[model samples]
Target: MREFSEDYLRRTRRGMWDDSREALAPLALESRSRILDVGCGTGELSRVLAAESPSGAEVVGCDADSALLEVAADCVPVVAGDAYELPFPDDAFDLVVCQALLINLPDPEAALAEFARVSSDLVAAVEPNNAAVSVDSSVDAEGDLERRARRAYLDGVETDVALGADARAAFEATPLEVLETRRYDHVRTVEPPYDEGAVVAARRKATGAGLADDRETMLSGGLTEGEYDDLRSEWRQMGRDVVEQMEAREYEREETVPFFVTVGHV
Candidate 1:
């Protein structure tokens, strides 16, 4: 498993989670309240929560990876801590917020229970809806291996610490009362400087993973002339399409893809 670097976290935090922050904003306690943000990559949400909290409220962000925490620490008071065993006393916080973290955990339920143990107030979480993938044919067409690979990678400690669809179920078992559920839709159109680097980085990483056949060959800089030409051509075309769409503002009016958001209170 490849542990995510702080650089990776910083790069991702800016672009990902278009929906989670919006869904969490309303449920967040007043600024004066103490809140803890688990898996606070780059402190994006932590900054928002801190600025929005009642004048005196404190926001604390924690992640296990010190590399990421270093970047996050600049924006918020960050601690190196584990979600399963929080370094806080019972009822230590007024609110606990975790987003895109459940699926990444080995024990989602235990993590939530730990949150409940530390906070006297509320526990809010957001996770990808695995069940909802059926609504999008393109993403759904990624096939079994790609799907399994994605799942495995997200669940790995070195990748996205995602907790997929089971986050809500895990939260339901705890003592918190369900407060609200909202769906926020987000549509990402990748192109140019924003996506090119990421795409290349991903392909390089895949190549390093030693995938079988042409895929591995392609990554390892050993693809045949035809294979290289075909793949690169397709990639270039896709990039051009994205750039064109972005230029035409075609995505502005497009409906955001649906992602579930649930809020609960103690």
Candidate 2:
């Protein structure tokens, strides 16, 4: 419930399905295919598919978040809709593709049931590898409270209220036959200047909102040289947790692989 907006997440955070665009190419028809991209945040994936389909496919992306739908509309025909109860008629799409969706839904099975209900042929799904939930908290710090907290925050239901590992289980429960599932470890390098200053400012504002006394000291002197080392440690560990938290794909030959893709059909 404390997560940023969908646009903010796109700008500030690396996605769990960055490679999903290419992964989904094979599942769709050449052209004239009507594809429904459920949970199509920002419409990045839907637009790509629509463009690539030589047959001139119509890719419609849907999301419950209207704010994101505004942004997604720019990329494709975005609808203000929900995955659980799609507004279209039965078997409305030749293919239904949902990448990195199952992992974030509280009722992924229900959503998948909807996917099955609407999809006439295939249902392609991408999800995080539950076995890939590894962490490298090798920081020589005093305690791993930060690491534990970070993991707890991510491993729990997302701030946006999505499922976690249970998403995969829910997908498996679907009546859809498992056509193909691949575990991909990809990482999107997130450089600094990542609006950390804004975070500092927000924290300060929050401290002020609560009328905390140590706001100035905490923002200024509290970030001491020694504290920076701790902060750096926290940052790195938190970054890893973020990748896991987002079900982010792992980069080839990277230290960690946080994202994966899975596709199936009924």
Candidate 3:
């Protein structure tokens, strides 16, 4: 499983579940008695599930990270557990769900089987199609460099990162039958009145302070050292331009990530 910090999880998942009610409606979660959210980190999705479900529904969150579970416990009932082996009885949940969990797993099909085993009614997966991400930035080089970097990162990923585009195959491998599929577009924007984190991130990019962290992964993914050096120089310049625009209060960027909500019935 992949490890994530509380800050990273919060930043990436911001505004994800805000407008996802339509995509989540097929499962009829309002009537569910027991809703289990596997691999729940920071309880973002679990909070939404709890709000959508009936008053008596037990919307629980489970994760392998104790620290994250501790944070999640404040929002919902959280348990320390792994997705491959949930610490619950068979047919223990009327609905089993996970948000952005399967794409990072080594064997998503096996996890889906476990989800099916624990769910008696519906199983849902909310995952992103990383390959189809689109970016529109005020700085042209920023968009281009981001595409190049994303390509390198995708190549270096050992797991099936594009699983959201073809998740039906995983369901076919399991005992559950596919019931519905819905598409959700998550749009992340950085504009005027930038937050403290965005300002800090732009400054880091301008100084190339964060480029070194991904250097090893890019090198292994066919990005030569010389090419990386050149990209860093350009990235720094673009970041500087962004800073200038920010000073003028004219910086804006929008990135759209397509996600799929696949619902399966046992």
lDDT of 2 by residue, 1-266 (tens): 12236744464224444544465554755843799988777776677677678888889998888888898888788887787899888889888877566666666778888998988878776555433443333223312433333333344333222333334456678887766555555554332333443344324322332113322333353344464444545545544444343333331112244444455566
**C-alpha lDDT of all candidate models, in order:** 0.60, 0.57, 0.87
Give the TM-scores of the predictions, in the order they appear.
0.66, 0.64, 0.95
Candidate 1: list runs displaced more than 4 Å: 16-21, 54-56, 130-166, 191-258
Residue 139 in candidate 3 has what lDDT? 80
Give the candidate number with the greatest lDDT: 3
Best by TM-score: 3
CA deviation > 4 Å runs, candidate 3: none
Q: For model 1, how does the per-residue alpha-carbon lDDT over 118-165 read when each residue is reduced to its tens digit? A: 988788776655433322212222233333333433332332233343
Clash counts for the predictions, in order: 12, 18, 0
Over all chains combined, what TM-score does candidate 1 have?
0.66
lDDT of candidate 1? 0.60
Worst 10 residues of 2 by lDDT: 246-255
Q: How are the candidates ranked when ordered by TM-score, highest leading?
A: 3, 1, 2
